[model samples]
Target: MDVVEFLSQRIAEDEAAARNLLNDRSVSESGKWYERRVLLECEAKKRLIGIVESARQAALAAMVRHPEGDTPWIPEAIEWTTLSLNALALPYVDHPDFERRWLGT
Candidate 1:
């Protein structure tokens, strides 16, 4: 598959994994043992995921309605996805590899 198709598949997989983790918060808690603060952070991540999903759906609908290229919806969907991914990584900002992994520093 092309890069775009590969990337799309990866994103779908990542979103699915995030949803699974959100559903099974107990597994994560057992691994890291987060307190109330982290629980709230998880909730925020869940909301971000929802936002990303909504943006993706909107983009897909737009693509279907207007097959003629050059639409702003694609970029808007990308922006939402990037912002949500960044927010998802915020809880790990203090990690040693955060800058290298997430920020590409």
Candidate 2:
């Protein structure tokens, strides 16, 4: 497809991922800590969704105005999307025993 179409698709994917994170219901509210953690995650996802959507809109607008030239907002969109994806990755990856050691207290 064209550049605009490609970017739009990527934006949609980002939006979808954010929605999924915010709407997550897999973890039941077993305890105070667990409930608090889930709420924090949802809030984070909401903020990420706003950032991604704003960047996507700017990129789309730029593409519309300058269809022949480079879309300047594309970089910002990519950056936000990358940050969002990075946040989804497991933290403390090298230390597989992190949670066990840290949370088992």
Candidates' lDDT values, in order? 0.56, 0.52
Writing each residue's lDDT as its tens digit, candidate 2 over 1-105 gives 322333334444555665555467663445444545555665665566566667767777777888886766676776665455444333432443223332222
Error of 1 at 57 (Å): 1.8
For residue 28, model 2's alpha carbon misses the true position, in angstroms, by 12
True-structure RMSD, every candidate: 8.4, 11.7
The CA-based lDDT of model 2 is what? 0.52
lDDT of 1 at 65: 82
How well does candidate 2 score on lDDT at residue 22?
A: 49
Assess candidate 2 and give its TM-score to the true structure.
0.43
Which ten residues in a row are the worst by lDDT in model 1?
Answer: 1-10
State each candidate's clash count.
0, 0
Whole-model lDDT, candidate 1? 0.56
Off by over 4 Å in 1: 1-34, 90-105
Model 2, stretches more than 4 Å misplaced? Answer: 1-30, 70-105
